[model samples]
Target: MIETHSSSLKTDQMFINLGPQHPSTHGVLRLGITLDGEVIVKAEPDVGYLHRGTEKLCEVRGYHHCVVVTDRWDYVSAMTNNLVFCLAAEKLMGLEIPARANYLRVAMCELNRIASHLLFFGTYGIDIGAFTPFLHAFREREMVLDLFEMVCGARMTYNYIRLGGVMADAPPGWADKTSEFLKYFKTKLREYDDLLSFNPIFLDRTKKVGIITAEQALDWGLSGPNLRGSGVSYDVRKTFPYSIYDKLDFKVCVGEAGSCWDRYYVRMREMAESVKIVEQCLAALPSGDIMAKGVAKIPTPLPGEAYAHVEGARGDLGIYLVSDGTSCPYRLHVRAPSYINLAILQEALVGLRVADMIAVLGSIDIVLGEVDR
Candidate 1:
């Protein structure tokens, strides 16, 4: 029997689906992956699982009503979404918001930025098999949500920022409460660094995995921390100053190496910088009307188009508005950063192990609501 055996063995590429229901995906996203053994041969991202025709919906709503629509785009950082859309509408109408309103806008947006990053930090830990960090990160994030709820009466999607100003000014003692959170958060950040940033296991998993070159990142339209992680110092707030950011003093955090760890570190440092900007804004907050008179009754602009963008937590969130002298927009388009940033996934996933692929996707920190919108 041992001398009579002659058989053929077959070897073929394996295809696996990593998404549409996976916990680590962070949202409804699917990845069609082809693998050779444990190594990834190719990866294709399948989006649109959460699309709701948001842009088309925006066209039907009135200018003021559209602000609420923008809330759902990047639901985690709705303040910045509101800011960008309101900025575009204000620019088109040629209206000037009050100084105090501008400062308040900056403060709220920075707080929202911290909230979004905390979510990324907590969830990214879960992706890497560290459950403890998720709890710690969310504990800090709840404090941010409390502050937001106090400001706007909503936690996730607060339509607080409006064209020509905010919905209202910060309530009494709001600035003091914000200051307390900033002080407490600084200590929490140090604790986070000690717990995970320097852990040997985390370093091993992320230090050299999923490297993206600076040129590759730029070519792929990567932005925010992802692009800066690749050693590119481009930030929409810095390159194109909007609102009161130009007057604020803060450094743009950049990573030294274009690795998963670098991308993670950049966001960590950015949280600290955001604290600084919020502190400055609180100290410089002026006393004046929160909204411009007659702004609520602003007529449509004279048959023109305008584009306004802000440095959102994910990246550059922009709105292109076209008007034909009508109350509702003739056409509206949103330049969502998450959608653009997620395009690099397929290229980044090649040759990585299945485990490493999860690590890479987690580092990208995408929200499918924004991507599929």
Candidate 2:
């Protein structure tokens, strides 16, 4: 009774939801993924889980309160958020910020960029199955927070950068503490290199995975490290030169291949460039009042429209502000880089194995707050 049965196994594409709730996702984002076996056939990112209509909210709020709302957009790098809004508002009002104030603005924003990238470093390592790097990254990040708290009482959502200038000058001991942290952070960057940046296991998962060519990247409207990773030399700071960035000397970190690893390493190198910018600003910090003189408490700029963009930690963050000769803005629209950067994921994630989904997503380093805002 050696009877044999013949059967044909059929496979169909299976659709699965990744998350608006999954921990692997950087924030509250939903990815509708279709898989055949373990490979993704198609991917769609559905954002807006954390939406609060921040741009609409900004229209009704006063100029002072608008800065506060901008904090919620890219919550991790709030100083840059504060700076872009203030720059747009200041442009409308025709106010001249002091030399010292501009230097302080550059220093604060650069320090915040370091902190934000440290967060990405730690979390991306965890996403790729290395936990020890998380511990090391946070140890240095805490020092940056300590420096921020010394200037602005708040650690995260600093309403410190304002319309004409910063909230106040950094405290007497703040510069020395920041200088010491910068010295220490540079050494840690090397430590990070040995620990995770060049780790063999990390490379296996990231290198040459989810490759986006320079033309593809530009077509998808990618920016920040993602754009630079594709060998594009377009940095808003270098091209537009807002605030004191023109005066500061530093190199733009660019990468080749446009792989997940390239994007990740570009951010790592940019931290060093940011360190140089901060050090230069601190060394050349001028003597003057932190706030501009003769600015009204309730600033009512003339009827007009002004657009201001900055090189945020994520990318080109801009504010399109329209004033109707009122304290409240007539319209406020945000060009959030995270929202733009996240769009390429649909194409990038396809053909990648399920195991690599997290590595690619984590390398994009998006904060959903900005996407949803």
Candidate 3:
């Protein structure tokens, strides 16, 4: 006779909150999780802890004044934000950016991409209990920030990229310094591989953990490394070819397994690709006016609507602008990639151990500034 044991009876599920203050949440994000034993049954993301209403602010500010506000969206990669906003404004006004300006924009955005990825590498390591990688990654990142400081005087929020052009050309000897940095950074990437990529513990923790299929990624609207890690080869730079990316040559890094390690490795490979792009941009940079001629202080755009997108560190960062033949945008909307990418947390967290939840979320690499904007 078959009989069910009393100990085998179903138990009540436990509900817990993971954030609103937890470091692993990566921002001010709060996650409400339902646990069956140690496994997650349901996960819901509670956001808006850092909301600043940036889109509404854009509508009230003049064209030039709005550029400064974009810096706060994804403060880690502010250059990309500045470039996207400027691109939308330029498109609406029918302005033509000079060749040199385009090259400079590409170089700055690539450098910011490297910086953002390095931060992810370090922070993800800490999330998984490896403190050493954080030091190594940050050491390299400081050098990149120094280069940015040389041009814009601010390390983090560089409001350097402007409408029709950049705020200024590279400082004297900046190109040589950047070339030197690229050389140094390439060697550091190898060290990172040795330290974390193939480490036995790291592999055990990340290799098959948090697996997501390409189809699932698409259904969830993932992009950038998060999508590429799922084996999708779509990249805004390749698909859209904005700025001077078409003029340069680089590979779009993709992963096969769609695990946490795959996402991590994709970012590592992307840093190398970004270095190649920067080297090419510096080599072929042309000389010309940094800003367009005769641009009005608060120039009005023709009545129309335009959307511009660029491959940001997180994903496809897009800006939608509506002009009513006025100096300020009538309406502005920002497509915050981090916010969109965070939606997949609910699917990814189910069936994962509470421990694995941190690894999965870290792989998404979200910044709350963008998520809550």
Candidate 4:
């Protein structure tokens, strides 16, 4: 108070809540931000506003029913959620999923990844003050949903990937329709570049704004596009080779600078890879039973534990299942990527402009349901 730092008086740290209502925070997230004038001194992400106790519920429900419960955790990428739980339960039961079922699993999960990224593509544009891109992104997202509805009968919370295999095989004409969609989607990637990716204003707003170094991303346990953006190159599909991912061919896209643009662009490039995987899956669609035989309606697994993980649209989604030779699980745990990835925001948000907080948060692409679960 006695002496000013410059021509103006010294600014005091001000604490403010960013969401649980605000639109830019994405979902019901509440970011307790401490701002020293326009600069953010600290950012604390307050979660559990959407907790559903899904892991606890899984312990009481039958192994088969737990698949549906997994859907709500990451509703944006529900197929991966369905797949991870199924992989864990199947491992515990030691079941051999059919070749066709595995192919279908891969196809569905890849398609789901495309759909989830599209949501991010649209919403992220809106987060940064651009409105046109959201319209185009949703137009394509609806088509993907139509394909999901064609086979699974549910759009968002699809209980398709199951204990032994998928809920059912793809119906007639579904494959051809998906191929047509892919052909059209490949052209739209460039259109996105013109709309948002390369816009001068967008580049200025996102580039070099929220830079997360490769080291920081690793220390915070980031994954999926977040990790890839930081040049980590960790994809469970590529590294662990789950399901039929090893049979398919695709590249792992990464970023150099690890800025907000890098994270956003990683997802954009991943969509192209997903298109390639879907094309290959359709071309090499195996012939066999969709659901494995001999899995009982209410079967019990041996007294042991199994863990399975998949490269979810958000990141490394995993499930751990424990069985005590009963139809119900002895204990269940989830290593939700959204939950783990959200941790970095607490540290990453420091030392940035208050406005850049939204930019950085949007780039990470956290889904509140998965975070709070």
* lDDT agreement with native, every candidate: 0.91, 0.93, 0.94, 0.92
Give the poorly placed runs of model 1, Cα more than 4 Å off. Answer: 1-10
lDDT of 4 at 104: 88
Cα-based TM-score, every candidate: 0.97, 0.97, 0.98, 0.98
The candidate 4 region of ten consecutive residues with least summed lDDT is: 1-10
Model 2 scores a C-alpha lDDT of: 0.93
Candidate 4 accuracy as lDDT: 0.92
The CA lDDT at 176 in model 2 is 94
Minimal lDDT window, size 10, model 1: 1-10
Clashes of each: 0, 0, 0, 0
Query: In terms of lDDT, which candidate is strongest?
Result: 3
lDDT (C-alpha) at residue 121 in model 1: 90
List, residue by residue over 216-300, the lDDT tens digit for candidate 3: 9999999999999999999999999888888789999999999999999999999999999999999999998888876778879
Candidate 1 shows a clash count of: 0
Candidate 2 lDDT, 1-373, residue by residue in tens: 7966555445788999999898889889999999988889999999989999988898888999899999999999999999999999999999999999999999999999999999999999999999999999999999999998999888899999998899989999899999999999999999999999999999999999989899999999998999999899899999999998887789999999999999999999999999999999989999889998877878899999999999999999999999999989999999999999999998999999998988999999999999999
Once model 1 is optimally superposed onto the true structure by TM-score, how far is the C-alpha of residue 314 displaced, in angstroms? 0.5
What lDDT does candidate 3 reach at residue 237? Answer: 98
Query: What tens digits encode model 1's per-residue C-alpha lDDT throughout 218-316?
Result: 999999999999999999999999998899899999997889999999999999999999999999999999998787564677789999999999998
lDDT of 1: 0.91
